[model samples]
Target: MTFKLTPKQEAQVSLISSDATHIMAYGGSRSGKTFGFVRAVLIRALAHKSRHAMLRYRFNHIKASIVLDTLPKVMELCFPGVADNCKLDKTDWYYSLPNGSEIWFGGLDDKERTEKILGQEYATLYLNECSQIPYASRNMAITRLAQKTPLRLKAYYDCNPPGMAHWTYRLFVERRDPDRRTPVANPGNFAAIMMNPKDNEANLDPKYLEELQSMSESMRRRFWLGQFADVTDTALWTLELLDQQRIVDGELPDMVRIVVAVDPSGVSGEEDKRSDEVGIVVCGLGNDGRGYILEDLSGRMSPADWGKAVVSAFDRHEADCVVAEENFGGAMVQEIIRSASADSSRKVGGQVPYRPVRASRGKIARAEPIAALFDQQKVSLVGLFPEMEDQLCAMTTAGYVGSRSPDRADAMIWGLASLFPAMTKQNAGPNGARSPVVNLGYKSMKRKRA
Candidate 1:
C-alpha cells in the first residue's frame, strides 16, 4: 500500500527517516504527522519482524479507535499488498507482518500497565500524540526500551506544538538545540521535523482553514495559530460582571463580619525590591449578601513592612479575621503579624491574626471556583480597586500566573473564601481543613484542554 505524503510531511520524514536514536515530529493538526511516524515504525518492525514492536498512544481506547481503526484504511491505500493482513483486534491496534513481525498497540495510562509490556525488548517504538503523555511516563517508557543487541531499536515521538505543560515539552522541544543537534532527513539521529498547516496544502480542506480564520482573535491565535492563550481570556471573570455599583471603597460597612487577606513576601531589604507586591485587602459582606472590597494595602515591602501594613488594614477596617496564604512563610507569617501588633508604635488591636492557609492548587483553579461564586451572584466586589481590576481583565485562558500579577485576584479569593469556607469544601483535606486556596500573591494552576 502506498499513501501519498503532503509536502510538509514529506519534508519532515526526509529529515527523520534513517538510523536515528530519536525522531521528534511536531506540527499543527492534520499535518499527516501520525501517519508518517507510524509508517516508519511499521517498516522498521518488519525489518526486524522476529523482535517485538509496539505503537503507543495516551490510552489504549484511543489507539484502538484512531490507529487500529483509521490507520489500516490509510495503510490499505498506501500499501495495497499488505492491506489483507492489516487486522484490528481487541487488544492490538495494528496488524501482523509475514516476517513474524507483529505490530501491536498499547496505551500509556499508568505505570503499572505500561510496565507490563516492558519485559520484552522492542525493535521499534512508536509514540502517537506524544504530547498527551506526562513527562514522567514518557521518560519511563523510553528507558524501558533498552535494546538486547543487533536488532536495532529506534523510537519516534509525534505531536504538535503548544504541548501540554508536561515535563516532556521542557526536556525535548524547549531544550533541543538546533545548532548543536545534527539534522537528519530520515530516522537516523535525534531530529525534530517541523510542519505547519500550510505545508500540507494539497490535503487540507480550504473551508477548514478559512473557518479557522473566522474564529475569534483569541481562539484563532490559540487553536489555529498555535499560540499560548492568556489566563484572563475566556476566564470566568470579566470586567462587565464586576458591576461598578457593587464596588465599595474608603470604609467597610458595619460588622457584617470583615475579612482581611494578606499575601506576605519573605524577602527583606534590597532583595524585596524586585519581588512582587505583597497585597493586603480588607473586605466584608453587606446586608444584601453582596461582598465589598473596602481597602487595599498592596505593594512590595519587607516582611516587617508588610506585616505592619497588614496590621494597619486590620485596625483601619476593624477586620473580623485575617486570612493569609501560608505556603512559603507558613506559621512565621502569623508570628510576624502578631509581633508587629504587639509593637508600641503600631499596637494593632486583636493581634492582626493570620489564618495561615496553605495553597495546594494553582492560582486559576483556586480562583475559578471563587469566580463562579461571583458569576452566580453569590459574592459581590465593593468599590473597584483599579489595579486589581486591571489584573482581572488581563487574565487569559492559561491563568493568572502567566501575567505575574495575580496579587489582587489572590487577595480577593482569600478574603471571600474565609467568609464562605463551605465554598471550597470539596477540596478540603482529610482533616476537613481546607487547603490555602487563596493568599495575597496569586499563583496559577496548569489547565489541560480536550
Candidate 2:
C-alpha cells in the first residue's frame, strides 16, 4: 500500500486519477512509465476488487523485454512477498494473484492469435509500446474491453513518439480536441494523455541525467529528449514530399495511365520457403494530377508464379505496362514470366517486355522519395496492407527484421516508374537510372535502437 512513486510516474498516476475513460502515459525510455502503471493496476484492482487485468506488448519482443525483465519487478514492488506464489507461466504469460484478480501478459505480434485473446472481458488493460500494434488492431482491442459487471473498466496506453500515421494515434493524440466542454463521442470512449520525459524529473536519477548528457546527439534525442527525429540532417526526402490529395473511396477518376511494378523472387511453393520475395505494386495517376499507390501483392514465389501474380494485377487494374529490375534475375526473369503467362493465354507483350533497372544506391536512397510522398499525403494506400506498412514504418538504417517486409516499397517504385515512365526517363542509362541524392532523416519517434 506504500510503494514509492517516481516523480514522472506520480504525474502520470495523478492524471489517470481523473474521470477520463482512457489515459495515455507516453514518453522517454527508463522513465518508469510501465512500472508506474503496474502499481496503478494493483491499486485499482485492490480498490474495486476487479476480476481481471491485462498487460500487453508487441508480440515478438514480449518475452525478453517486458515479461522477463520488467514484469517481475512490477509484481515484487506491488505484491511484495507474494512474488514466490505468483507463477510465471511461459505458455500463458500471466500471473495470478490471491485476490482473484489476475494479470495477463501478451503481445500483438501475431494478429490472429492476439485477436483470440481480445475476446476476453477485462477490467483494466495496460499496453506497452502501443505504437507497435497496427492502428486497426489497436482499435479492435480497445473496443473489445467491455464488461457487463460495471467493474469500473479502464484502459492504460503508454508509448513513445512519433506514433504511426495510423488512426489510433490520430484519434487519440494528433487530432485537436473537439470543444473541451463537449465530450467527443468516439468508438473506444477512452481518455488519452501525453507527457515529456522532463515532466518526470523526480523519477530520473542524477546519474542517468549525467549519462544522458554524455551520450551522442542521436542517443540524447532518442532517450532523454524524447523527440521524433532523424539521425542525419541531409535526407534524400524530407517530410515536404507528401502531396495532400484526398482519396475518395469508390470514386473512379479519369486521367493518366496506371502502371505495375514488380520485384519478383526466385522460389515457389505453398510454404514460405522462398529465398526472396516478389513484390508487385500497382500505382496510378489521378486526373487531379496526384500520385496514388493502389495495391500491394507481395510474397514468396518462383519467376513463373510471380508472373501470374503480375498478370493478375495487370488485369485487375488494367495497367498500361509493367516495369521490373533486371539486376537479380536478368532477362531470364522476363522469359520465365512470359512462359508462365503463356500458359494462361495471356502474353506479357511478346516475351515479357521488362524494363531493365539496376540498384546503384542503398535501400534508403530508393525509399526516401517514396516516404516523402507518404508524408506529403500525396500517396494514399487504397487498401490496408499491414505487412508492407509494418516494414516501411519499422525500417531503420541499421536494419529491420521483426516488423514487415520492404516488398511493398520495391513494388511502389516499380509501379510509379512504370505508370509515369517519363518521371525516371531523363536519368535512364544503359546501366541503370541515376537516382537523386536522398537525405536520410532520422526517426520522428522515440524507438529503442537495438
Candidate 3:
C-alpha cells in the first residue's frame, strides 16, 4: 500500500524522530496533528521495547475519539496488513506490539485510573487534547516520564490552540517558566510548531473550510488559524467569571416566574439565504429574587419552526409566558406562535400567552444592565452552555464582536428584564438617570385554558 502524507505531517514526523524531550504540534482542526503524532508513537513503539501511555482529559473521550476513530486509521495507514500481529487488551485499554512494546490509554479525570497510570513509568507520553487537561495533572504526568529503555524519552502534545492564558502557551510558545514567571532563553529540549487547516486540505471535506470561515473571528483564529488569542481583556465576559457564578442543576430555589424569551430571526422560510439563528432562552426569577438561566434552545430556524420551539419550552418548563422581541416581525411574530401552538402534533390546547417587546435602544445599551446583573452576582447559570456562554462572553459595552448575532444573549437579557423590572429603569441612561420603560401595551386575547 502506498500512503502519502502532507508536508506538515512530514515535518511533524521528522520532529518526532528528533531528540526533542518535549514536542508540541499545535494546529487547527483536521490538520492531521493527531494522526501524525499517533504514527510517530507507533514508529517509536515498534522500533524499541518500551512502555508508553496515551492520555486525554477523560478516558471515555479517548476511547470515543482516538481509540474508535484515529488509532485504527493510523494502524491501517502505517502498518498495512499487520493487524493480526498486534494484541489489544480491552479490559486494561492497552495494546502489545510484536516488538514487545506496550501502549496504555488513560484519562486524568478519573483519580484512581490517573494514580495507576502515574504509578507506572513510560518511555513515551502522548497527551492528546492537552488543552483540556489541567496544569496540575500535566505537571504530575510529566514527573512519570521516566522508563529505562533504549528509545529516547520524549513527550508529544497536540491540541487546537486555546486561550493565550493556557499553560501550553506560556510554557512552549512563550518559553516561560509557569511557576517562576520567568523566560527561559534557551528552552533546550522544548519545541513547538503551528499548523493550519490549509496545510492538510486534502484530508478535509471541501465544505469544512466554508464552515470554518463562517465561524466567529475569535473562534476562527483559534480553530482555523491556529493562534492563541487573549480572550480576557478583549471580551467583556471571561470563562472565570462564568465558572465562578455557575450553579449546579437543582441548586436553585422555587421560581416565582419562569419566562421563555425569543429573539426572532427575520428569515421566514427554510429556503431563505440567511441562516440567522432564533435565540430562545429559558430563565426564571428564583424565590430568592436571583435570576437563574435554565436553558438555551437557540437555533437557525424559520418562523414556524422557532415558534414551535418557543411553545415546547413553554410547556416543558410550565412557563408563565413567551416574551418575543417584535423588532423584526411585529404582529406576525405573535401569529406564528399561535399557528405553531395550534398544531395537533404539539398537543398544545388553548391560547399560549405571547408578550411582544420592541427594542427601543441598541443591543449594547439594552445589554449593559444584564452585564451589570452578572457582575453584581444577581444572575447565575444553571448548567454549562458552551455556545451560549461563548456569545455571552463575546459581548462588550461597545457592542457584540462575535461573528454571529448575539441573539442568545439578547434573549437572556429580555428574560432578566421581565423578572427584574428595575433593570430596565434604574441606571439605564448615560448620566445615571432613569430611562422610561417602553410600554408593552398589554393586550390579552381571550382563549380557553389548556
Q: Count the backbone clashes (under 3 Å) in each candidate.
A: 41, 23, 0
Model 3 spans with C-alpha error above 4 angstroms: 233-261, 264-277, 281-305, 309-336, 351-390, 395-405, 410-450
Better of 1 and 2 by lDDT: 1
Model 1, span 207-237: residue lDDT tens: 8777656654544543366443233336555
- TM-scores of the candidates are 0.49, 0.49, 0.69
Which of candidates 2 and 3 is the stronger one according to lDDT? 3
Which residue runs does candidate 2 get wrong by more than 4 Å? 1-3, 48-57, 163-169, 174-183, 186-222, 227-365, 368-450
State the RMSD for candidate 3: 9.0
Superposed model 1: Cα runs more than 4 Å off: 1-3, 50-57, 92-94, 148-151, 163-168, 174-189, 216-223, 226-450
Tens digits of per-residue lDDT for model 3, 69-155: 888899998788666799888898898899889999998878999998889999989998876677787889989999998888999
After superposition on all C-alphas, the RMSD of every candidate to the true structure, in Å, is 17.4, 16.3, 9.0
